[model samples]
Structures are given as C-alpha cells and as structure tokens.
Target: MSTIRDIVILCNNRMAFPAIQTLHSLGRLHSIGVPVENEDVKAFCAVFASDTGINLIIIEKSKLKFQLQEITAIKDLKFIFTMTFPWKIPEELIRQHPNLFYNFHYGLLPEMRGADPVFQSIKKQKNETGISVHAIEKEIDKGKIILRKTLPLHTDFTHGMLCTHLSYLASYILPEVLTLLHRNDEGMHQDETVAEYYKKPTIADVSIQWEHQDSKSIQALVNACNPWNKGAYTHWNGLNVRIVEVSQTDTLSADQHAPGTILEINENKGLIIQCYNNTQLRINTVYTDEGFMSGHKLLAFGIKNGEQFATL
Candidate 1:
C-alpha cells in the first residue's frame, strides 16, 4: 500500500478511466492530459478534473512535443503514464526522460505487442491475453516490461468487451507497477527473440477472406470487429455488407459448393453459408446500407438462398 505522488496521465478515451481512478485514489495523479481533438474524452476529463480537483491539460495533437516538453519541466513531475494516447512522443523527448515515461498497453508484449492487440488477439482466436506496463522507449511498445496482468479471453468476448476488461486490469496492476517504480526497479528487458509488433488494424485486416477462412476463423473475425469496426467486411452481390454476429452450424457444406456459397436459409436456423472447410456459419445479424438488421432480413434486400457472398 505504498502511496506515490507527482504523476501525469496522457490518454484519449474511456480505456484510461480505470487507471486514472486508481492513480487518483493513491493521490499520485497530479494531472491528466487529453488531446483537444478527442471531443468526448476532452469533455469528460474536463469535468473529472473539476470534480476531483486534479489539473487538466488540453493538448493539441500537432503541438504534442512542445506541450510535453513544457509539462515535463515541472520540478515536481516524477512520472508520466500514457494510456491509449494517440501521438507518438518525439524520439528525442523519450531519450531525454526515458525513466519518466511509461505506458499501459492493453496487450501481452513480446507476442501481442501492437497498437490494436485487443482486436488482433480476438481475430487470431487467442484464448488468453493481458495488459503490459512498460517503460516508454524510442520504439513504440518495445519498452522493457514493468508488470503484466493477464486474463482469460472468453469465447463470447468482442473487441469492445476485451478492451473494457483490460482497462480494469490496468487499474488492478497499477499499484504494483508504482511500487516497483518507487523502489527504482529497472524492470526486465523484453525478449527480442520472441518479440513481435502489430500495427493498428486497417480495413483490409477486418475484411473477411472467404477463400481461406473456415467457420471458426470467420466467427472470430466477426467478434473481433463488432461494436468497433461495425463488423467483418465483405461483399454480397456487388454490395458492401458487414457480418455482425454469427455462430457455427452443425451442417457441413457439399464438396461442389465453393466457400462463401449460400447453403441454406432456414427461419429457425438462420442464414447458413459455406466456409473454407466443409463447415458452415450461421449468420445471426448483419449490417448493410439500409441499416443493422436480422440476418433473415437480407432476403428482403434480394439476397436469396443461392446468392453468394465472396471476398471483394
């Protein structure tokens, strides 16, 4: 229960809420910095700062380097923590205050190291993931590890769900991290041999690869994209569509039918489609230009039982 002080947090969204609370409770949160471009986070932090009597610094994304240099000049500034902060710190700034900065990355480092590991882990069908607190170094997410708190990746977890879970995990792990830092612990260096880096996911990453992905893989992709990217992107009869929710079906596809073929459309069983293997996926919900609707409603949009949805 070692209480620390003179800390600042840089963040852009709700993922930082838990950590902010933990630091404030310990009386270690001296200030919070939010990019002015992030309207919701900016407004929320403004009110939070007022209520908690913590200082709030509004930052311009373009002027991040200058602003950070100024903020770090405070004689009492002991540590700076960034949680989901958007801009990369200037390499020179990191080099100058290497010990003063740390980041709470919402992913397991050395394996799931990346900007969007929450999405990547779910998309890759990993059964476990964790949060990593590491010193901020020149290379992004390549810092030495201070602490890691892992959790089971539940089968029903979507990208949003896992993000929420990991945010709380960050709060739970923060005290231990602060205690280590208070003791001047240098922390362990990451294993370069097993290290990997995942850049932020893009449209192509969320797009479904019908030709290569089986039913399980497709379902994982769907979960990985839901409530975040809307869903897994695909094309149906020349129209863009997103598969929002799906489940594996017991029925196997016939050898003659290619992957992405519409095998059946049962009212009770939902819309079933062929996948890479003989397995099938039962679509529960979908999103189209019309709106988000039930999978069965695709019939009204002229998607018949034989209509196929293939990769673009």
Candidate 2:
C-alpha cells in the first residue's frame, strides 16, 4: 500500500494561490498560512475563511522564527512545501526533516538561483526562464531539483506579467511534483559549476546606464523593472525621471553625440535618445516629478533636443 503524506504549505504571495487551491481541492493539504500581513496574504485568508476544513495560521513577521520552531513539533508532518514564504526555514528543522522539505522557486535551478530571478532573467534578455521544484537545504536555492517547467521569455513582459504567468505555471506543475514525492523519488542534484546567484535589485541596480549600455539592453532593463520598481530611471535637471516604456530605433544618426543626449523629439515617433554603440532608444512613456506623461510632453517641460539626461 502507498503511504499518504501529510503536507504543510507555507506561502504569502498571490503567485501561490492557484497551487494552494489545487492542493486544497485534493484534500491532501494539511495547513496553510503566511508569515506576515500583506494584501496578498489578506486576500488568501479572506477567501479561505469560509472553508472550516482547512487550518490557516498567520504568523507575525517578527515571531516567524519562534512559530516555525513550534511547527517542527507537529506530529506526522510528512512534508513541508514552501511557496514564496518570506522567511528562511531554520537549518535545524531542515536537518531534522531531511528530504521532507521542498520549495517552489520561480527560476530554473542552478542557473538563476537567488531572489528576483524573473527580473534578472529579463534584464539579461534571456531566451527562456522556468520554475523549479527543489529540496530546501542549508544554502539558499542550492538544492536538488525535483521538477522544472520552462517558458519562453518575451521581451515585452513586465515584472507583474512575468510573475502572473509563473504563478499559473506553478499551479500546473505542483500535482506532478507531489506525485513524485509520494513515490519517494530523490531529485537530481544541481551542478555548482554552472550556478549563478543574484541579489535583490536595488534602485542603483535598475537605474539606466545610458553611457555604458546599448539601446537594446536599456530597453530590457526598463521592461524588467516595470510595474514593480516603476521602471529604469535617470536624472533630468536634478529630478528623477523614470522611463516606463521604450523601443529600440533602427534609425541611426550620422553625427556623434554624448550618450543620453536627446537626439530627436517627434510627436508621432516619440523622443529619441542617443545610447552606446550609436544606437537610440525611443521613449514611449515616462514618469517625472510632474506626473506620468508621454515622451512628446517632455518638450513642453523645457526638455529639448541636445539636453543630456544624467545617470547616477
């Protein structure tokens, strides 16, 4: 006879909602909750409140460590599946649980290990990105890969769009991963030689490097940071200016101008700025101190041709 595993799901993000619902419908989900209060967490709690069959535990962010310690004492907890759980699981608990702990990471294992993989993948202009189901270990994301599902990386995908797509993908693959675990299938180990890690991007990291990067790279950076970091940024007359939507222009200028210099201002074609490699970026949408406006409106705000946007 096959053993039925009692699974505890710890998640706080909306991306895990679909997967949570899938597990709940199967009647195999043991417990669910978040480590903190947020819009996503509140939404999940409110939706599941009517279902008295499932137990939801909302641990205070400050008391998460203590609460996780208490969870370790739950008898017959065969597996713990963490989906976008904010806090790191205690190493002691992982050691005690052995192969029972697993996590759903947004990025492919080994290659895009660490925080904000979608953003990194978009910034790097990757051809593909995927989700990974892996064992949780002492190191962050350096775990054994159980299952993976790849998706095409679209150039126009904003931060929010990529996250939404990944969430659905997570929901789709989770049942298969559970089946694999039930069969006691040990996952494949990750290759450390090809591994890459990225820290959460700061404002500086996402800021547009007009002089150093080409137009294509700049456009990718802007798209990668959208609907989350509010797009890649620059400085205009000491004021912060965010480029929300941009496109690379095939039109090349014969005359050389400093990078970040406004090359052309056309109502139909938008504002064009010189970038590295003699390329140009056509700004479609922008956010400045005044408010969100199109590139053509910048001319009315004293931004003219030959004006250079400063980078910090």
Candidate 3:
C-alpha cells in the first residue's frame, strides 16, 4: 500500500487561497500557514478563522527554521509546497528535505522567472504564459519542472486578471501534481539555455515613454500595470496622471505632431494621444490628482488637445 504524505503549505498571496482550500477539503494538507509580518497573510488567514478542521499558523520568517524543526520532530513531513511565499528558504533546510520542497511559480519555467511574471508577460506582449510547478532550489526559478500548465493571454488581460486566471489554473492542476509526487516521480529537468529572468517592474519600467514606444507597446504597458501596480504613469500639467486603461485606435492623423501630443479630444472617442510609428492610442480611463475618471473627463481638469504629457 502507498503511504500517505504529510504536506505543509506556505502561502502569502490570495492567489493560492483556492489551492489551499482544495487541499484542505481533500484532507491531503497537514497545515497551511503564512509569515505573520505581512498584512496580506493575515488577511488570508482571517478568511478561514471559523474553520475548525484547518489550522492556520502565523510564524515569523526568522523563526520559520525553528518552527519547522519542531514540527518535524512531532510529524513526518514529507513535502513543503510554497505558493507566493515572500522569504527564501535556506539551502540547509532544502538539503535536509531533499526532493520534498516544491514551489508553484506563476510563470513558465526557464523564462519569465521573477517577482512579477504576469506583469512582465503582459508588458512583453506574450500571447501565452503558464504556471510552473517545480522543485525548489537556491536559485530562483532555476529548479526542474515537475508540471507546467499553459494559459492563453488575451490583449485585454490586466495584471490582476492574468494572476487570478493563473491562480485558478494552479489550483486545478495541484492535485495531479501531488499524485505524481506520491508516485515517486522526479519530473523533468529544465533547459538552462533558454532560461530568462525578469525583475519586478519599478515605477520607471511602467512609466509611459510616449516618444520611444508605439501605440501597441504603450497599451501593453498600461494593461500590464492595471489593478495591481495601478497603471503606467506620466505627468500632465504638473499633476500625476496615471493611464489606467488605453486602446489602440484605428484613427490616423496626417498632421505631424510630437509624441505625447493630444491630437484629439471628444466625449465619444476619448483622449487621442499621438504615439511613435504614426500610431495613436485612445485613453479609455485615467487617474488624476482629483480621482479616477474617464478619458473624456480630462477636459474638466484643464487638459487641452494641444498639450503634451511630460515624460518622467
């Protein structure tokens, strides 16, 4: 008879909540916990406060080693699944656990490996991205792949949208991955040749570069930053203007205008901004000093058709 594995899950973000609940419902999870220092972790724990069957422990990142040592003394923990866990596990602990440590990275392994893969994927205009379940190693996302599930990326998917979709996909495939691990499958090795890593997007990375980027690229940046990082930003008339949502327009202007110039403004058509490569982008939504407003409302804030957005 096959032995049942005792598994502990460490998660911080809401994306992993569905998967945690699934494992708990199946009676496959030993415990689910998060680092106590993070507010997001606390918020997630609050959602399950009434559940008597599931135990949620909040341990400090610094104390996790000792906590794990104590838990290992009482129970035979065969695996640790990390989902959006903030801190990096020590190499010594991983060495002790051997093949028992695994991480669910919300990106295709060997590429788009980093803090915010969904955002990076969107900004890069990738048509498809995926979730990678892999062995945890000292190097971030350099681990061998145990399982990977691809997700199609639509042009309109924002950071939050893509992440939510990937989270659902992760939960759906987790059971099969656990089954494979229980069967003593080591999974497949990742190719190092094609591996690429992306850093988390900073304010500068998301800042709209109207002079350098075409309409499609700018729209991608806006989509990548939405509902999480907020949106790609630019200064307009000394006020911080966040381009929350934009769309590539089919309209073309024969008039030569500098990039970032407001070519047209109409309530029905939105704010049309000239971009590189003779393309124009219609601003659908924006956030200004006043508050979030539609593109047509920019006129009320003193935004004129002849003015240009300043580059940061």
Candidate 4:
C-alpha cells in the first residue's frame, strides 16, 4: 500500500477545487497557496482553511521568494502540485527540493504545451484532447511526463465544457499520480520533435475569419470562444456581433454568394450564411449591444439576405 502525505496545492481557479477536496479527504493536504490577486480562489481557500484547519498561503508575486521559503519550512512537506498557477515556479525552488513539484496541464503535453491550450485545442478542431501530469521544470510545460488521461473531443464541445471535463479528470487521476511519484517514478522526457507551443490568444485570435474558413471551421472557432468570449466575433452592417451558437448546414450556396454573405433568413432555421467552398452555416444565436438574441432577430435591425459580414 502506498501512503501519500503532506501535499500542497497552488492554483488560480475553480478547476483545482476537486483536487483540493480529494487531497483533504485523504488527509494528505498540508496547505493551499493562492495568488493575492485572484480573489475567488483566495476566498475559497480562506473558507476551506477555516473549516479544515489547514494553512492558507497568499502568494504575492513580488514577495514569492520569501513566502515560498517559509512554506518549505513547514514540517513533513512532501509534494507540491500546481494547476494553472499563472506564474512559473522559481528555478531555485525546484533545484532545492528535487522532484518535489508537479503540474496538471489541461491539454496533452508535447503536442499542446502552452497557455490556454484548452481554447487552442478546440479552435484547432482536434479530435481528442487530454490532461498531462508532469514534473515542473524551469521552462513552461516542458517537464517530463508522469501520465496523461485523454477524452474524445466532440465537435459540439465548447471551451467551457472541455475545461470542466479536464478539471474533473485531474481530480480522478491524482491518487494514481501520487502513487507513481511515491514509488520514485521520474516519468519520461517529452519528445521535442512533435512539441508545439502557442501563446495566449489576443482578441484578434478569436475573431471569425469568414473569408478563408469553411463552415465547420467557423463552427469550431465559435465553440472555442463560447462563454469566455461570448462567441467568435464579426462585424455586419456597421454593427459588431458575436455568433454565440452556430451549426454547419449541408446546403450549398451559389458561386455569386461569397463567404459571409447572408443567403436566407428562416424563422425556424435562423440566418443562413455562405462560407468558404460554397458551403453554408446556420447561425442560431448572436450577441450584440442589446445582449444575446436569435440570429433571425437581425431582420428587425435592417439586416438583409444580400448583406455580407465585414472582412475585418
């Protein structure tokens, strides 16, 4: 039987809540670390600490060095786990406590090793995505892998939906991961050949590229940006709009109808728009200054079937 003890978790969001709960139940949690700026996590940690009598460490970025040093002094400290910690752990800390740190990445390692991999995975239309448990190295997400748990990436899955699934996945696999670490498993090095790194997306990255992208591609982009960004945005008739819900249609458009051109507006079908390769998409929901509205409601705003969405 493997015994796990005295683990600390550093996290920035609700995604780590399940993991924290699991550790607390197992009596292996030592304390929780939260960024001073993240109010929600700090508050959650405060309440949890009050109820469970566990320590809550506030991580001020400027004073992280001293705070981290203090944490290490706590008796019987064993392992440290981080999930979307917002900042990199100092190299000196990892060197001092060799193999003491592990991070849960929301996407598969090597293939998706960068910020916001959840959003990027969906935007890229990946057929599958996963969570990776790896040793924390000096570089971002460059650590050797301990294990990975994957789930099918459904076409209808939104960024928020995938995030929730990955969070639960992390909790579900924590015990096995801890057992592996306890047995002196150093894990395998990541293959650099297939590795990729993507930076955090800017507003421009979430915008719909109607001209060159096909209907299915556009739908994927929309799903990737849901809730977080409302949806993939575009401008039409001088009004900015976000397509909240969309689905690719089997219908084909005439050559004269360029991509982004509105082909028809059906009460039941919503707005039908031309897409690249003469394909079409049914726009179900949209967000504007008036808030979220059905795509067909654009008719009241003087939008017509022939008008095209602005390319920019």
Stretches > 4 Å off in candidate 4: 1-5
Tell me the alpha-carbon RMSD of every candidate.
1.6, 2.2, 1.8, 1.6
Cand. 4 TM to true fold: 0.95
- Expressed as tens digits, the lDDT of each residue in 1-312 for candidate 3 is 123437778888888888877776666677777888778767766667446355567878779888766655546677888899887878888887788789999988888788988888999999899999999988988888899899999999998888889888988997789888878788788898888888877879989998899999998999998987668899887788889999878988778988999988879778999998899999989987688888878898788887899789
In candidate 1, how many Å is residue 150 off? 1.6
Q: What are the runs in model 3 whose C-alpha is more than 4 Å off? A: 1-5
Each prediction's TM-score against the native?
0.95, 0.92, 0.94, 0.95
Using alpha carbons, what is the TM-score of model 3? 0.94
Candidate 1 deviates by what RMSD?
Answer: 1.6
Which has the better lDDT: candidate 1, or candidate 3? 1
lDDT of 1 by residue, 1-312 (tens): 434458999998799999998899988898899998899998888899999999899999778899999989876788999999988888899889868999888888878887888898898888899988899888888888898888999767988888899889998888789889989888789998888888788888999998999999999999999888889999987789899999877986445678888887767767889888677888899998889988887888777777789786
**Cα-based lDDT at residue 105, candidate 1:** 86
| Tens digits of lDDT, candidate 2, 139-212 | 99988899989999998888788899999999888779878887888899999999999998987888998889
